[model samples]
Target: MAVHRSRRWSFGGLALLVSAGLASAVLINTSDAATNRANAATVTTTTTFSDDFDGAAGSAPDSAKWSLETGGSGNGNHELEYYTNSTSNAALDGKGDLVVTARKNTDSGLQCWYGTCQYTSARLNTAKTFTQKYGHFESRIKVPKGQGVWPAFWMLGDDLGSVGWPGSGEIDVMENVGYEPGTVHGTIHGPGYSGAGGLGAAYTLPNGTSFADDFHTFAVDWSPSAITWSVDGQTYETRTPADAGSNKWVFDHPFDIILNFAVGGDWPGNPDSSTSFPQTMTVDYVHVTTSDSGSTSGSTGGSTGGTTRTGAIKGIGGMCVDVAGGSSDDGTPIQLHNCTGNDAQKWTLGSDGTVRALGKCLDVKAASHDDGAVVQLYTCNGTSAQQWTYTSAKDLTNTGADKCLDAKDNSSADGTRLQIWTCSGNANQKWTVG
Candidate 1:
């Protein structure tokens, strides 16, 4: 099990940095902070793995699917729980759920990093049974409530034994500390962006309803180009290589799953007088679906399904549609530049009806419908602003604005910014969908 850290995070483009032990985060770029959440339907997928915890009450999880990780070293997060393989710590409920409990017990005579063990809990993992590259990975869970209680569903790259953390990479699909009962986080950690500096975002329940009150779905749609996080089907954030600043994106390999209920970690602090013990995190199921080809199908409401086209999009003066500086950061200008065959000049026409490069979508600025609106590379939100239609005539049009992608001022020279204008079938608006 990989012990992770947390810190400053975001929701859309809003900045909210929180510190957890030695971790903290900084704002790197803009995201599509839409008031309305994305409800776009997804493409087809094939079930790859599933577990419903449907064994007899008090029974352990199927040995074929899970391995109990026993320890009291705090897993590097300063956690207070001494993990055990006993049924008292982890068992399947007759009601079709797996319950991992944390209890305030000293009878085990366990030794922790702080001396005597104060609590006992369970950490279950699929490290030996399963590993996958890219797809939709999800879990439905009901967390425990009380200060110092932490529940998380996450993954670590299978290369941990060789490359180690932040190098092997980690993805937190859902994580919650007791202090924030209505909120859960989704984060990713990699080189140059680990610990408190990890990039992530928060999703809070409306009307302040606690997650402990019911089961909720937390998931991430992962592909070679981007990772999108959603809570109960509502998309709250998406991260691409651009969001990593200048750091390398290390999520292109296989990873294994982890589920744990911790107590008194560095992020949640020590359990206090008001805290309750014997807290249990109930998991309804863990399900994963993948694209047969090893990458996720394009997002919803764009192209139905087709082979991805990657190359340069040639326009007037034979210049290519390029991302400024080859940066994946949101708001990076989409312009016409001399074909250098570099990553900046590379564009992918996805089956999702979006044009992309550097892990971002070609977006219409602010979802604007007005002519002369700037076009840039932003997070893929499956919104009309990010959807494009490539016609047989080689015209790249924004579906929402219904405008042709135009070269500003009809200039063919390099560094010409691209914009959306009323369709005119002019040479500047014509493009080759590479």
Candidate 2:
């Protein structure tokens, strides 16, 4: 599992690695990717939470805003680093930075739950400390780079323990792999779109500028209906219900913030000969604001200039998808009715993981992915059942079940119910959206 390139790694136990030819040990060069992105956003001064990390070097992070999460249970990604609460792994640098370091564990007798420890890092969260439903969440940081390095600033639902991952929802504000020193990613994950399949996009520095060379702000402006992702204030992506296809949207609840640095896992794979030890991800600040000063109107709009894709989800028999009777009810049967070019068939796919119609979303009932699980029109909540991916093959598959959105019995009738079924490459399971 010694991959050497840039690619996403899921939290489950699978691995995929590719090498994009990163210059080894390149001296840090300055860039304005962060400054430009930041100047593009209008974050309000009304603060709901903030930490400048002004503590003296060697001290722990503020206990009121962050709790150190320890252990190395692979975090469900089959990661290779032991997470620790030790000051050596995470502590404020005298220079006003929260340094989360990944190092080669030197204690010979020390072992992880699985085997002898080789690496150690840190994970910090605001689990029971501070959870919020919406607003602006931002952080300024300089990330480290090297093969197998995985650094992220993200959030999870406060009910994570009870609901578990995808059901609890995950929002990745910023994540950078060491092999891709010039790029960073932001994504949202639920039961369906967790791991590498989570809906997201990468922001690459212009002219091959390395993001690891300088500090930049990563952020998301979240509302009841949509989420807008940005880098340094430059809005690059926005997601809504329609973007999730037939998956459920499950992000309306409160969530906790998390920051972690991982090494040698599924996506980035294991570090090899060129990899270095004792890497650090430095954070200068973390802030949250409840202000609406930077929001866009309507159920799907944002100021960050993120991509907004709108089209029709045309399925079998050349019919367009629709909400039966164009109703707004929760269980309105999704059908393959005639294309009337009305709002009932209008779908807006967004950077956020949602597929929206009539301002509602296409969702899998109860988040089920069974062969016959029903699809319906429902209010968006950022759940997995509502997450959709329009693959190159034109198949509409649910992230949760990995099943194709199918026409019941291959029927072309106006009121045929849509369901998830085994993807057999049949006409009934293929779809087209522009």
Candidate 3:
């Protein structure tokens, strides 16, 4: 087993070692556009729950949640051998994280159709098992160092089986290698530019540190109007359907997640003589979250001036409130109030981790808080009551109970107090703002 590289690496000579070619091009355009695709017929299924590799003991991924894809002819680049389901390639422990190890192994029984193949590794996905239309998708990962070591956390359309690649669309959440240690790329691939001509962008971290050294969170927030990529919590790049040419707007469809570590490929070129073997991409965890249509209303704030609201708070001070009424519990309906010190006015914005508010952290009471449960302000401790989540539809639920914040009798009138009630599929539970 190779020691995981989780600290940033040195990149002092990157400027001289690599030429600035087409990779530095930044195509700038201006247009406010969004895709108006009919919502895909989604099944109302129970959400899957799993550990996020953040606990005491780290474990393997859930076998039921992932499927390994092996065999590689070196797509575009002459690379190493395929990763079979053997000891030297892949393994899953069901704890929510997957480890894909690459090493020089001759008897691994895996062979690639391309150049001097001598290694095995892994590629995993949640294709047929689970797919989401719109939400936040993120992965905490540490990539391997060395030229030609290509590791990517990306997504492809779930309908790829029928529609095929490119036409189904591709979303590269993170792609990094040893050569460009401090820089990572995020791109979307569709019909016209699917393979190499696709539209994308690259972000370089502060000079001196490379991603291979530390575990960084790569994420994308997909919504109706636009898509934005971020490192940790900072925005890097954003794209809208209008920015894509007519045939390239395949992002309207649902996409499944994929995590893979590839050796030498056409893009990254081949590993040089100085390259080291046994490179590995260690994943901390992967999380997916979705919102109901119009659950919360607010704008996504970032360094960019364009503010498009898509449920989640894109930046600090992003708030969603019901200024017209109070709660059925006789409490005031939570409003997107300013960051005041008041308990009822404060809100803890989370990407996928957890929620915090006031001096105490909010949790889902009993870890089963369902529909209509009174969402009260509690201590900042990590408890169930403070764990309230608003889906794309804006239905707020405490994970500890079965109650939800329900509009009293589904009233649209002013002052319609939000009360705790049984989980009922009604307009009262439906919130649409973003």
Candidate number achieving the greatest TM-score relative to the actual structure: 1
Deviation from native of the Cα of residue 409 in model 2, angstroms: 65
Better of 1 and 3 by lDDT: 1
Q: How close is candidate 3 to the true structure, as a TM-score?
A: 0.58
Q: What are the TM-scores, per candidate, against the unseen true structure?
A: 0.61, 0.59, 0.58
The candidate with the higher TM-score, 1 or 3, is: 1
Worst 10 residues of 3 by lDDT: 18-27
Candidate 1 per-residue C-alpha lDDT over 1-434 given as tens digits, one digit per residue, 9 for 90 to 100: 12345421111101111111000000111222121111111222355668999989999999888888776787777888888889999999989999999998767579888888999998887767776666567789999998999999888776676666667788889999999899998888989988877888888887889999999887776666677666654456677889888898988777777888989877877789999888999999998764322233221111112233556899999999999988878899999999998878766654445676765788999999999999998977779898775655566777687788999999998999999998787899888754
**Which candidate, 1 or 2, would have the higher TM-score against the true structure?**
1
**Residue-by-residue lDDT tens digits, candidate 2, 333-433:** 99898889886887765333457675577899999868999999897676878766545566666666667789999998888899988667789987877
For every model in order, what is the number of clashing pairs? 3, 43, 65
- Best of the two (2, 3) by lDDT: 2
Global lDDT of each model?
0.73, 0.69, 0.52
Model 1 / residue 346 / CA error / Å: 28
User: What tens digits encode model 3's per-residue C-alpha lDDT throughout 297-344?
Assistant: 111111111122322221112333332222223222343333233333
- Which regions of candidate 2 deviate over 4 angstroms? 1-45, 292-434
Q: Which predicted model would earn the best lDDT?
A: 1
